[model samples]
Target: MSEDLIDEDEGPKKRVLSNSQVLGFVMRLWLRRPVLLAAAVGLMLVAIGFDLALPHAARMLVDAVTAGPANADAAWAAWALFVGVYLAFTVIRNIAFRFWNPLASRNMKELTDEAFKKVQSFSADWHADNFAGATVRKLTRAMWGYDQVSDAVVLWLGPAFLVLFGLSVMMILRWPAVGLFSLLAVTAYVATTLLMNKYYTRPANLKSVALDSRIGGALADAVSSNPTVRAFGAEAREEARIAEVSDAWRAAALKTWTRFMDVGLIQNVLLVILQAGLTGLLLRQWQAGRASPGDVAFAITSFMLMSGYLRNVGENIRMLQRGLDDVEDVANFARQAPQVRDVAGARPFAGELGEIVFDKVTFRYKSADEPIYQDFSLRIRPGERVALVGPTGAGKSTFVKLIQRLYDVQGGRILIDAQDIAHVDQGSLRRAIAVVPQDPALFHRTIAENIGYARPEATLAEIELAARRARAHEFIARLPRGYETLVGERGVKLSGGERQRVAIARAFLADAPILVLDEATSSLDVETERQVQAAMEELMVGRTTIVIAHRLSTIRSADRILVFDDGRIVEEGRHAELVGRGGAYARLHAVTQGAAE
Candidate 1:
């Protein structure tokens, strides 16, 4: 995450960003490409200068013809010069557009990359609350919005103003009254544009963008939850829910366009009246011999140019508002802070991980009232095989999470080999531990890719060896595509046992010194479980291991068993010792054993 994106006192709740701030953020990206943008703007102005000069040339031709045979040669020469300049700038305009577009595209790409990296750096809790679809939509729209705004401002709006400025100079030199009216018209148009955009167009555009985000989120939720909808035969209900969001989006779209068009109507009416009234007054001046025929020609041409300028200004203002909304969306995502961060001057873990100690650790979830662990302390010796046995909600999984620094403890500290875990780099600490979860999550990628995920550079032979050790190679070999078969999202295409085997294979490939098995074999049948248990035994050799035991039979050979109740250790001993004592572990073990029988 970049320092500029952070607010020292930022909270989980979103901060309302102002329009100037959002626009300023986007302009920073543009500032990085100053040379390219400046050249483009220069070329654009040259083109506008030509456009402004053409009208004066037309006026000169008109006055020369009115001057009769005396000015015929000068009139023909002026006409020829005008045609040549027009052709020259026609080529220049083409070149400028070609050069400018690529720079805008490059700027957009750079901004997208920065925004994506920022989003990935956010904490897990922030991601959990923010929908993936909405985030994706925001990113997509932000890049596109930058492109649209660049075109509206640099290519059209800026050039239009240049033409107006040049024309105002010519109008004043030719006729004072016309020049005064021209300046007033420009001021009125600008004021009206600013007023309409702020009061009506901008708010409507923001509402529409919010609706688009909601619609996208709803669609993503329904599609990802397809299995749930189909299992209950509620396809129609799901469709209706999506329809509800889509209808709202439609209404928002209608409202935005209606407001924009209504404002546009008033602006066009004002321009028409100004042009008509100005032309009539100029015509009378020409009839009275106070103004030349050329002055009347200049007046008509300038009015037409002003009309075009007004239209482009209105369009750009709307585009500018839409772009601002997109910038706000991406900026909000970038502002979220990662909950777990390395301490100052954090270094990489050194050498081997010999032991782990939870020293007076206290922890609680953000939403929970009571602490899950209150001053909890524990120590695990090097290469010890320990099993944690308890009912659900006993803080087994959370212990693993804290060990991995997925979340930090609220009080005290955890140490590994006498080094505090919080004082080391997060990536280094996580790389030392391997976890095989009960229900492993996989990407929509090939089977081999999933197996080699922990060690991406693993060779085919190494992957096969890991698969064989996990007792997964035989089934994989029989599949149509073997290791190349695509596992649907979350490995849904595979059976429960297959997914477990794949996860185990990934762990085998990882070969980390500290291993965690959270009911790793719970998903398999009795026969498959026995085979996997043998493989797990081999994998655990000479490694510090912690197992969250659901099936008591699997932990019989563990060197130590810690029985938990209500988030505290109730008993600690060998399985045989616990059973003989007839304590909480014994009663729980007996219940599990009887159920299996």
Candidate 2:
């Protein structure tokens, strides 16, 4: 991987999202499954209602018993009502979870799918700029973060708030002083937690999360480059690098967790104050003969309920913070607009004639100080075989990418069969052209799958035919499981020549009107290249072909050869004419005569 590709720049990292933003994002997903969400939420409300009936029932029972043995039946009825309410609450909460669990899981899956789709839609350069492993870590972590967020909202915070509100209302209706104290304590506790978390804990937690992502990226980078590590005997150096990152994460995580404990301690003290104040208020009311024993019992029961609910709320708040931190990465991903976007109402590219035209085009990379191509124009007629001859960093690859509309030109239009590529759907445009890159990377799948990837609907017979046409079937036949053999990651199990042939076979299977050969045979040996070149000659007969020639001698038979330097076409002619003219192409041929031939 290039140094520029691993963009783990921490200084300009993503901003942290607020609770509402995170929850609102989740709620939007829930709205998609309206019935399930409604059922779950409705059940939670019913459960809270049943649970709130208990303290009132306790009050009723105390009053009934205080009226003496004449009220024994009423006392028993109150006790029975309380137990029934308790059981009802338990059942409804369980039912709520049944609905909530599936909804959470489904939404997590959908969120992941949506994030992956957005990442895929990002430009090739955007992908190069980000760490692949870090992106994976964010996607996976955010999925679980959403699960925690959903749990905090539906299971803990929602019920806790409802219980607090209901209990506080009942207290206010019976004992004003106690109710006011309870409300004040809760408000103070929540405020303190929010303030401390925002100022003290959040920075540490965010840093730890960033380092954790770096660790994932580091591991992926090292492991993927294991061959290089072993060749250079840099195992210890790699371990030290990992330890350095891991140690930073450890310190940050410790500080973040300790900050939570600090906040927890303060909230617990406030809880104690709340309990003491309520007890003192109840005693004063009773001593003044202004409150009955039943009222005192209700006060005690409500205090217990409020205390437990408040504690739960405090814990849920902490969980919510952790979830918010984790989800911030993916949320930012959604916020960043894609570098390349299709025009509105873009039509599918309908192609049978492969005539390609670049008319008055101008293009430059964002990082580049100068434009790569300015007002550059060219046209390749249908069934023409055109070869681009140039040193690297010239406009050859960009030319191919432009035709596929990978990056939109700043000015002018690129067209295929007279249809403007920028105005066509990307997938449809790319499907009309087949590209075999210089360094062909394959998925870790069977040879058959690799070849069939170009056309998933291709039959086994069709795959074999394509493979034979590209001279890949001979070596594949010698493999242990033939087409069923799994190529290791990026086809590491195969030689470079083998991978290149497989790529060519895939192009053969594509059956597109246009074909791009980006140094296609550069990986092959002399004998293999001869065989593959023979096959390519047959394949190029009826298609408009663009070859980014690595070996200049190989393109002598092209209908026309273009010599490129910097960003412009310096010379254009047949091979003999250009050689006889003793210009740029002839100079290039003379310089590389031994190696190119």
Q: Which candidate should be chosen as best, given TM-score against the real structure?
A: 2
- Candidate with top lDDT is 2
lDDT of 1 by residue, 1-597 (tens): 122332211123455567777777777777787887787877877877778877777778778888998888998987786686677668778878877887888888988998898887666677787777877888999998887777777787778777776677677777777777777777677688878888887767776787787777788888888889999999999999889888988988999999989888888887887797679878988888887888788788778877787788888877877887777777665555667888889999763755889999999988799989999999999899999999898988888888888888999899987889999998888878888888898999999999999899999999999999998999999999999999998899998888888988998998887899999887788887887788889889888899998899989999999988777998999999999999999899889989988
- TM-scores, in order shown? 0.91, 0.94
The sequence of per-residue lDDT tens digits that candidate 2 reaches over residues 470-496 is 888999999989999999888989988
Worst 10 residues of 1 by lDDT: 1-10
User: lDDT of each prediction vs. the true structure?
Assistant: 0.82, 0.85
lDDT of 2: 0.85
What are the RMSDs of all candidates, in order? 3.7, 3.4
Question: Model 1 compared with the native: what TM-score?
Answer: 0.91
| Residue 399's lDDT in candidate 1 | 85
Q: Summing lDDT over every window of 10 consecutive residues in candidate 2, give the lowest-scoring window.
A: 1-10
